[model samples]
Target: MQDKLSKFEKAALLLLMLLAGIFGGLIRYFHLKYGFDALGLAVRGNRHAVILAALFALITLAFAVVIVLALTGRLFPKDAVAVGTIGAPTILLSALSALAAAVGTIVTLASAVKQLSVWGMLNGILFFAAAILTVPVVRKLSVRSDSASPIGTASLIIVFWSCFRLIEVYRTVSSTPSVSVYFYDLAALISLILMFFGCAGYLYGRSGAMRVYLTVAAYLFFGTVSLVGKGGLCLSALFSGAPVAMANVTDVCVYLYGFLFALAVIPTFFAPRRADPVAELIQAAAEPEESGKEEPPVL
Candidate 1:
């Protein structure tokens, strides 16, 4: 039954991902050719090539925030708030990365760094911090068998892996005396370990970390792959005019991949599971009986 549900989830998530990719492709294609000046963004040079970068970032942030909010109770559904406890720090982590990006973009131009290394590295730091900050919430929700654990884990894992380009940034900034190689190395190590634990949790039916790991790992691995490939193309497009077509094509493919990934993930989040309601009820029933028996019988 678990296997059956896993299979169904895989199929459904694939469809969700496929649709997202298709939508991404169409939107990117149009934006690259016509531009998104109305939305306060201009698709010039590599910017056109990386329109999908923003798309991926937006999707990831949205998913992460939603999951974190659900777990921490900041965004609980209906009147469910009084039932369980939620954490505030986790809620803040959910919202901070997006906030950082928005503020960073507004205050600092992308050109502040001569190399994509700096920008990429900063993103990695933000992502890692975001992921680490979420662990408490994910653990909290998961331990309680709440629905939000998988999402929380996934969000953190995704954030952790999505920062892969940080390696490149690390290499780039290695020469600068001010940059701490040790700091980044430590961060990288920590992220990888968390990612592994997250995946392990999922495979073992430890839904708290597993859900997070699966969601995060899928997004991180695929997202980083797509972004790294396209980020390079975007750089090329910025310098050369004729490669615009190639860049747009790359953008489309990335979108398609991302879309397919989403489709695959969403359903896993919903797939039916082997829940033991009877077992749960029995356990609950037994606990009280044991407690009452432990107390002195009515004097």
Candidate 2:
């Protein structure tokens, strides 16, 4: 109906959204590697690592609130509070859980190479698998004309966060000399690559006729980033004698950059497009004739 946003306004908003995603990803990445407490939290939890995790949890909650408010004022405004409240908590929890897993993996591995027993390693596998399973379900869900499904979008966010941590696990454990050890890390690394591509395809509007091609491309992009982040971490750790803190930070930098690049697609998906009111009017006029309606008297 009304064009509330000028081209400049639209461009600026798009840029802001992209920045938000990048910053958000960076925040999550840092929370994962260092433990929120280590990042400068005054009150620490035996249960929680840092005040930062709680703070990030709060930030994710805010995103949920804003998205809910927008949806409520627009399409689903009536149920906005309920949806936002219900879904926001999940987002917060998922982010926290992901961070915890990363911290756990790093601490466990760093303590000694032998600490990653069969069960510990298996737990990591399951975490990675849960994320991998989510990819297909997410891509299968129908995105609405105006917005991505809340559930689907949230799942993707979880996938990225978890998969990133899975990469962290690999970076930590691969330093050990055990051959059996490297296999799991290697597999997780490959899995991360696969998931990234799938994410890219779903973002690229590849759900249509060219779905197969798009899926492959999406997976490929994801794989490339996974490889780069992991490979870089490995090479750097080799030279620097990676303390756990620095290793975590290296992981954060790699993921931060990857997410930033991935975020560029967000603008194209949400960008403004041209419309034709005249054609719509002409079509409306012809509809009455086709329905056998007589023209009214001109008087």
Tens-digit per-residue lDDT, 26-129, candidate 2? 43333333432443332234222343245435544654564454434542222211100113333343344344435444544443345646544554454444
Q: Could you tell me which 10 consecutive residues in candidate 1 have the lowest summed lDDT?
A: 77-86
Return the lDDT, model 1, position 283: 97
Q: What is the TM-score of each candidate against the true structure?
A: 0.32, 0.34
Give candidate 1's TM-score.
0.32
User: Model 2, 185: alpha-carbon shift in Å?
Assistant: 17
Best by TM-score: 2
Off by over 4 Å in 1: 1-21, 26-61, 76-197, 203-266, 276-299
Tens-digit lDDT track of model 1 for 1-299:
75455445444443554455445544444443454345434535545336555665766576566557646645433322211222444344434433433433322223334345465445545444443443343333423443345454555454354344345445654665422212322232334344445533543345453344234434443343333444444655757874433443323232222323222233333433335577899999999888887656897
The best candidate in terms of lDDT: 1
User: Which parts of model 2 have CA positions greater than 4 angstroms off?
Assistant: 1-51, 74-261, 272-293
C-alpha lDDT of all candidate models, in order? 0.42, 0.40
